[model samples]
Target: MQALTYLEEYHSFKEAALNSRFLKHKTIQQLIKKLPEAFEQRCIGQSHEGRDINLIQWGNGSIKVFLWSQMHGDEATGTMALFDLFNFLQLPQFQEISSLLAKSCTLYLLPMVNPDGAERFVRRNAQQIDINRDFNHQVSPEARLLKNTRAEINPHFGFNLHDQSTLWSVKKTGKPATLSYLAPAFDEALSVNEVRQNAMLVIAQMYKYLNPLLPQQIGLFDDEYEARAFGDNFQAAGTSTILIEAGGMFGDEEKQEIRKYFFLSILSGLYAISTRNYVEEPLQHYFSIPKNNKEIFHILIKNLLHQDIRVSIGLSYEEEPAEQGYATVKTYTIKDIGDLDHLGAYHIYKEETLQIEGPIDIYQPANFTLKKDNMILLSFKNGILQSKL
Candidate 1:
């Protein structure tokens, strides 16, 4: 079947993921109401805010696949992909695949695991518990609901869905917008077990399908077994769980393009599990992509000398919540007197600087005091200059 296209035409991870016109609670309710009788919606539990935690179950296949998303409320990219998959399954063109899969295995989906967090665009629930890290305690309503739901379904294959920061790359060597996965380890020591190996086999096959499209942008996440993590708990329970972390599609202004890739990856994973098309060898190219790092700033001015002391200046961008129309810009403390390694190369002029004649509108650098006669201006892309009076 042709891959599902992203709903948005433009591609920005935050934009696409944050667009809730169709994925909101009301919209989801409407869609669920419209679903055919074959699909069943059950209230698994209540969230921290008393919102119903709903689960939609379809199909009667032997090999059950459980998929959940939005555990981190702000991480909505995977939730978008989940809805897209739902819509795809409902399409006429996908009927054959859907029907076939339905007859062979049950598909359970919890698209919005943290409704309260989603509303606030935060990572934690209303009580501030990270559901992902609450598995052991299961104190949070969302975590308890998930645990109960898992016990009820006892799915053979579990898909723990999430989105990662732009800093993440598949291999430490490739471009951004990479996809990553982890076959949940079965033991607390994170020992490689048969279930994990089987999950890896499917991941290897899925990599074959995604490599051509994503190239070096696909990677494996570290298989650390955290007692509170949902993936680890599920794996420890003997369910083969796959953690899909969508990450780093640079310049994907709307995240629409990345969403499509994520859709394709999901399809590939489903196919791998259903068909048992496990590849024996791991994808070595997975390690070719660069690891994600936060060392680089959004903007940087380099090669500046103050009082004969050479230093590098960096600026990082911060965005306000969606409610805030404009993003507040600020400068933060960064590494100084360092080489260009792991940093942007920007040159600054030794003589030119910013002049302050009156009260400043914004905070000035602590080290560089503003002078009325000295003018600060940026130099040819590489340097910052302080104009001498």
Candidate 2:
């Protein structure tokens, strides 16, 4: 019954979840068997593909908290965190939290809310409807199911969990990943209410628990009104809904570290809600951290072209599974322009060559001249040059 460190715990959980044989449907079933006492299975509705939407309910109390993750099937990071949190709740150390959760607050979780889309690793459901945007129309079965469930429970608080891409980072920051939250505006006026404030309070507390682990990687999401968004709908219903967006972290391509931070944040959030400690202010040290950004490239070359006409070039490489093995595609971007005096007055040229067995061929700018037989390279004597191969 030893406590596992954050990295060890999250890696273990991720490996198991990723290697599971079942799709979303079977995954939910397996989870129920793994934690039968803590999880009660209930039907939400059927997807466009006739898949039964599932719900797992734990704890029965007057104060209800609703948490739904993986509304976007391809966004599996938050869903994984939810599973880890469930496991933590079952631990002996969390017996008090578990007992209080059952007696004081009813925790309702719908993991992998979009099963049809989840199967194909898609953002939308089987009907091509973004569940988050379907709140207003209730056109998609997944959306309707969530709405109905919310009405039935009338939860006091709602956690809309999601994941964002690595391209997004805080403004003027270098952190690779950020955990952001938003207290959805109740109406079109964008006016803040007690419910919104309460959601912020909870978010601020969660930030406190996560900041030490993630530092400047925590952020606040912009609050905008989307009639169909789940958070907006829940906020309009007078429930304090907090939108948690798990984003990129530096050096964690798979986001395993960010996942662990999310698990701890959820635990802190639940603890705060149960104790009504929403007013507790986070440490100022959390604000001193910078945000995440996409400024860095995989490879950067400076003072090219004999160092005369200077230019800072950045090359980014992406690896994708291929029929044979893996294919690496290289993209080039001009990051900066250095001293132009060295090159007198020159122009930039690009050469591209494709080779199946050996290096690619090379061509001059505008394909006017064939420069070399193999290898892709860019020659910039003046101004700036950028291209991809």
Candidate 3:
């Protein structure tokens, strides 16, 4: 209920400092230093590159809830939402929900778990290890620190936040999976114990509240068991782990809009736990949520002449960090060619008489110009979008 209210007034608490997805360790540190006295902030450990991994603690209730984000430096959406939640918790305007959370739950937030990877805007740490997959081995210091922190807290609930590929779409709706949730499976058989089931119930509650706003854009992430992933292990260790992934939106490239929904999701989940209302949610609702599928593309071109045959083309971009991680360079490539008529795309061009001025090669960089009536409509040079005239 409060979440819906917060949705209308999210701008008041949104973290303006983290307006972009290219968040660095220093930027977050400066923001952390400015947190109100209500939040207890400390340096929990150092990253592989000597960046301080900080933990901000709030509330003092019996329910221990641990939320961590940016395990993959590139997935900064969750960290931004966490900061927004921090602002929400500090504001007196929403003191009713704040009071409820403070009285019913204790929140431990670890933002930017992989600062080194974030520094380069890459998915892996400086040692080239995926921290999430290093759980069983503990080879990376960051992974070790995360594991030790979880063991120390032994939290009742865990929120594993990350971003997913923009190409993932909701089944049947053809809408981008802007946000996805999953109750990670602990075992190989994907069995549901009380711990895992509680997570599903919380996700169901979150879905019930979020679906109205997001519609078919919200989807359930795959539940395959990952033995080396933190969420699965945390669930096996008795913490009901809920995974929230921020995916793509049509025009919200920086995820500024998606971050709001992500923030509300966490708030809604917290509301469910604080009020103990998730138990009333039926298990069927969780299963009923749409599963993610790769039925979307960054750009789709249809009814274009290619070798005298009409075809549809799907283009996807590969992003590389640039300018010391301050920005990214996207190189669009022809991921699929032929019949992509059923798939959805962020940008689509479907003209009955469109001509291609260059070669169309599957799995190759996009290097062509699309024209209609001898007028250039779209142009790409070596995978870089040139112009839309």
Candidate 4:
């Protein structure tokens, strides 16, 4: 029953979405104006381009939680999911959640942390410095604003949000990591202190809830301690920080489906934080989430009888901007050619008799056609490959 309610809430929110990929400062400004009287807005600081870095607050409880997304300009998935969360927060339909969240928590949201980078859809700020790695140096003004906000609020929990590449697959499964989470370690020791454990427990519950729906599509990020990262620094400052990376889903090119899981995790996290429901969760489940594996390819061809010998190849897609807008398309290249007896891919093809039709020049464009008995079976143009086999 609760799962159904969650789905219904997401549907209602998505149906009323005001913005998706083209979410800029003006869009956010106009959208927040329509928020119910419960929401309070403030200009925390200015970006490198003099854009207002805004903060929106709701609820009044002592369990203060701060969530910021799009620190990297190109990572827009979290920003979209946040607005979906905002829509759900305002609905009279979710009165029970509204009451529960309001009574026991204080939520602060900072979506689109790098508006300048978002404008260009680049990874860094306009200054070309990555905010996530600028904790001590303070190379960007946006970085300073986030540090100041953290100092001002002293939130009990911090959510360091961003989008990850679609190519990451679950270890040994070849399934895309639709969503990944991490409880940032507070120190180089990477020990699970009480504060860090709080984050793990909440994450464990989220993984438990999502595993049934997503199966092998979840992952645990490698916890190599980075002293300059916000999540690590926040954890060091005694704020339990959880990192959520929005990866790819099967056909969620716009990440609409992945956004639903993001919304669900946020809802579940708030409830767990408010109720301490995570305290009873097993820590092993947190570790059980597959470690982020970078070995997988987007597509693979195996067991093809080429010249009477089986051959396998791996192909990786590169993101290229589309003709006329902020939209982009993928262009694939042959990353490797070998006996890949172990690697997994979401899309795999097996052919009894296959021929890698010319011109098979390695430096040329990733264009090819597969033929069997003088008949074209598959053709890969640019990055998209369509196969009849």
- List model 4 lDDT by residue over 216-308, tens digit each: 888998899998899999988888899999988776767878888887877778888888789899888788788879767776778765555
How many clashes does each candidate structure show, in the order listed?
Answer: 39, 7, 0, 0
- TM-score per candidate, chains pooled: 0.76, 0.74, 0.98, 0.92
Worst 10 residues of 2 by lDDT: 361-370
Which candidate achieves the best TM-score against the true structure?
Answer: 3
Candidate 3 lDDT, 201-318, residue by residue in tens: 9999999999999999999999999899999999999999999999999899999999999999999999999999999999999999999999998889987778877889999999
Query: Can you write out model 1's per-residue Cα lDDT over 3-81, one digit (the tens) per residue?
Result: 3232232132222223541245545556666767778888778788887778999888899989998898766677777
lDDT (Cα, 0-100) at 72 in candidate 3: 98
TM-score of 4: 0.92
**In candidate 1, which residue ranges exceed 4 Å CA deviation?**
1-23, 279-297, 300-337, 341-389
Clashes of 2: 7
Superpose all Cα atoms of candidate 4 onto the true structure and report the RMSD in Å to 1 decimal.
2.4
Taken over the whole model, the C-alpha lDDT of each candidate is: 0.64, 0.64, 0.93, 0.81
Q: What ordering of candidates by TM-score runs from best to worst? A: 3, 4, 1, 2
RMSD of each: 6.6, 8.0, 1.0, 2.4
Instruction: Point out the worst 10-residue segment of candidate 3 by lDDT.
Output: 1-10
Task: Give one digit per residue, the lDDT tens place, for model 2 in 297-362.
Answer: 433344444223444433333323232211212232333344422221112332233122212112
TM-score of predicted model 1?
0.76
